[model samples]
Target: MAYVISDDCIACGTCIDECPVGAISEGDKYSINPDMCTECGTCADVCPSEAIHQG
Candidate 1:
């Protein structure tokens, strides 16, 4: 499963930097490109709001 950014995301850009594959991108709530996501859970680890989840 890929990581999905939830509405709780404040778009703080924290997860973006943690993404090893650069799958995270800026958006209304920030977005994860499923194709690019490796399901590494890196973004989830760095997300201050705990907004990234496995889909």
Candidate 2:
């Protein structure tokens, strides 16, 4: 399953750099494109707010 970034995200860029598949993108809140995400959980690990969760 791909990870999803919730509203709780603080707009921190940690997930962007941690994403091995480069699926995370910057926006009002960072988002993980399911089509591109590899479900490696790298983004969740780096998220300070624990905003990224299983989708």
lDDT of 1 by residue, 1-55 (tens): 9989889999998887777789988978899999999999989999889988999
**Candidate 2: tens digits of C-alpha lDDT, residues 28-55:** 8988889999888888888899999999
**lDDT (0-100) at residue 23 of candidate 1?**
93
Worst 10 residues of 2 by lDDT: 12-21
Query: What RMSD does each model have against the real structure?
Result: 0.7, 0.6
Candidate 2 wrongly placed segments (more than 4 Å): none
What TM-score fits each model?
0.93, 0.94
